[model samples]
Target chain A: MRPKIYLFGDSITEASFDDGGWGASLAHHFSRSVDVVLRGYSGYNTRWALHVLERVFPAVDSGGEGVGDGVVPLAVTVFFGANDACLPDRCSAFQHVPLHEYKQNLLAIVSFLKKRWPTTLVLLITPPPIDEEGRLQYPYVENPLGLPERTNEAAGAYAGACVAVAGECGIPVVDLWTKMQQFPNWEKAYLRDGLHLTQIGNKIVFEEVVTSLREKGLSLEILPVDLPLISEIDPNDPLKDFQK
Target chain B: MRPKIYLFGDSITEASFDDGGWGASLAHHFSRSVDVVLRGYSGYNTRWALHVLERVFPAVDSGGEGVGDGVVPLAVTVFFGANDACLPDRCSAFQHVPLHEYKQNLLAIVSFLKKRWPTTLVLLITPPPIDEEGRLQYPYVENPLGLPERTNEAAGAYAGACVAVAGECGIPVVDLWTKMQQFPNWEKAYLRDGLHLTQIGNKIVFEEVVTSLREKGLSLEILPVDLPLISEIDPNDPLKDFQK
Candidate 1:
């Protein structure tokens, strides 16, 4: 049986952006040896994903006869927290759960999953940085300046917290933020309005993630890249603006 | 402007049966002055709902319109924890969390909401008891045995904990479990599988809840019941076998 891998997180992991999402691309790279299940929902943060994992994943009575049965992915990848940082009510003082609390939520998920699937490799992926413009076109931004400065600070802190928590739990992390920063014109690599990544950006993310996994000594096979599909979305297409 | 009341919880408050959920029915009961938003998801426990409130509710960006400009609801009714009694993962040492922890989780939400909406009326509802057969048949039951024995005990303890915690937080609780026990043939009124209530069962629940609110001295108006359209399944339909 192929190793089953479950990808859980927010839109960044869900919107396989025309099949360029890290999860979808990772599945293509690993081919039959690794089956990936995308359990990503746009606009979800780590806290919400933890809730989804708790409420939805376990109670699923798939009965082993469903389309995705027996494809128990041996790995689970988690990418979240972007949306959490930007939510106004949550960021407000009264319910202001600092990065510390966010870390606790992430740790709880890791602990819960590790206990259930002791050997299932878990990868915690830090979300890519919000563009310098700071505007996420979709979800209707109330502030033209995009996310508040505090939110950005929180996002970065959240990424670092994820790394620390994952390290404490003995799980590996795919540092997408750090890796994506290395790209030339990192902001342009993302789609216009700047929240989600462009195709090339997603491919870059997928490559970095796979490389990290291979370095960890996992015998992950990389399938040939579908170049034609990847090139269809121009790196400079200004007219294709869609708010994610 | 009508007062905004947000009802959050599991199946019981969700009114899972064809009978309008408690939240919806409550909204109908207060049709003129209260604008109740039923934000309940079935199978969600307190832990997850806290996360949802943190992440999901905030992102609901109401475009600066609506009551309180989409801030936390003026009156938040929290009825959760039924599913929390279920084991989150196989490795969870305790199938159900200790009552102390459940109290902590419930208190966290109440405190957070209270701090945000200082004057927001927070209603903490104790869920109804699971019947002997241990199923929540209003919708369906995945586990006929309901929760393990220890879990059921923990649930009862959690109820007391909720009362104590709410009292400490200066919040009010509607003890549905205690009230439901007073009704003769409570089991028969509930769905055959046992966990969830039938239409009549829900009506009984609604009456108790309203009575509790009135006793608390809230000058809320209760509308006449229009009787929501329910599912065709009857609790005593002969063709429906519980064994299946």
Candidate 2:
């Protein structure tokens, strides 16, 4: 039985089930060695995700007789905090939890999971950037202020904060913000609103993860890629615009 | 124009708006030196309040308009993090941010306000406890592994985390949790849901804030009470149960 790779996050991960999300690409890319489980919610933040894990994960009851066989150790990747940034009223019903709190929340999850699965490797992925137009055309970027005037800088700070927290917790980080920024015309590569990624963007992120894993000495034989060839398609054909 | 002391928080502060909430009582208690602005929202957390401040405060723009005259040095007392503890799935869309994130979010607000009003004294209040059986009749407790367990410990932890963060930020904390825990029957003191405060709880929190202010050397003469008799009302009277 293949080990499971749990994709836990907000819309970015949840969007994987759709035609152009990274989850689909990731699943295809690592089909043989891992079973992918998407536990993404559209408009969730770190605080809420921690609650979900606290309530739902424990209920899964991975005991062989209860949940089923092939329920061994799993790799969990957490991506959250975008929607949390856009809350209308910071202290109203929702908290635009400061970056520090976001880090602590992530740490709590890592700490909790580490206790449960001592050897489980947890990966933290910083959410991608929201384009200048300020729409989170993805599932949820509620920032009423629109993207911060200094969005790249703000996004970088947020991602750096995530990396710092992950480093403090000894967890690995996949810096999606930097990787996405490297793309030429990233805004164009994004969907209309620029919060969610275009297919090319998702593919790039997926490849980054694969590259990171390979660099870490992890075997790729276990994770398989069964998706149709991307190379056969024209690179810039107007009809090839998958985002449309 | 009297100097304004804005009292912002969740239900405990919101209740003051009604005959039962301590806001009115506190207003009466400190009417001389301060003009208390009760901006309280029920079912709110630090996240939402920060959002509100971001939106509302920016409109109060402290720039060249000569506008924020009376509000320039406004003092704020923030009491929140109760509804945040009752999240069905902490990560769900229903609001209830996780504890750690809640703290960071609160700190962000503090930082933002401090930048706006460097001399403005901000008070951080950890809300009191809710008796699960009395006010909170729902499945407020977590039933991990099918074993029912009270989440009061988690709630307490959330409060403690808030205190820690506040302490780190050098903000004053009104320790409502410690004081409220001393009550004999906290559940009965609360309204039906065990989440919000009873009239008694609100009063106690209100007194604590007043006492904290006096301790800070703020003069009470400028803000004299209009109604001094309300505090003398018996907390045990059934007819006086303000939680309803």
What is the iRMS for every candidate structure? Answer: 23.6, 27.0
Worst lDDT window (10 residues) for model 2 chain B? B226-235
- Per-residue lDDT of candidate 1, residues B158-223 (tens digit): 667777877898777877666676778776775444556676666766676677667665445342
Off by over 4 Å in 1: A59-72, A87-97, A132-141, A144-151, A220-244, B1-244
For residues B1-244, write the lDDT of model 2, one tens digit per residue.
Answer: 3356766666566545443355545544443334455455555567666655643344233352211332454468877777667544432224466777888888887887778777777888875665545432454334343321224665687788778877988878887777777767766674445556655666676678777776665556544422212233232341232222
Q: Write the per-residue lDDT of candidate 2 for residues A54-119, one digit (tens) a residue.
A: 533442333422112224445777787665554334212142456777778888988877776766
lDDT, candidate 1, residue A203?
77
TM for every model, in the order presented, reads: 0.41, 0.42
| Candidate 2 ranges beyond 4 A from true positions | A1-244, B59-70, B88-93, B135-150, B190-192, B221-244
Candidate 2: how large is its RMSD?
26.6
TM-score of chain A of each: 0.74, 0.76
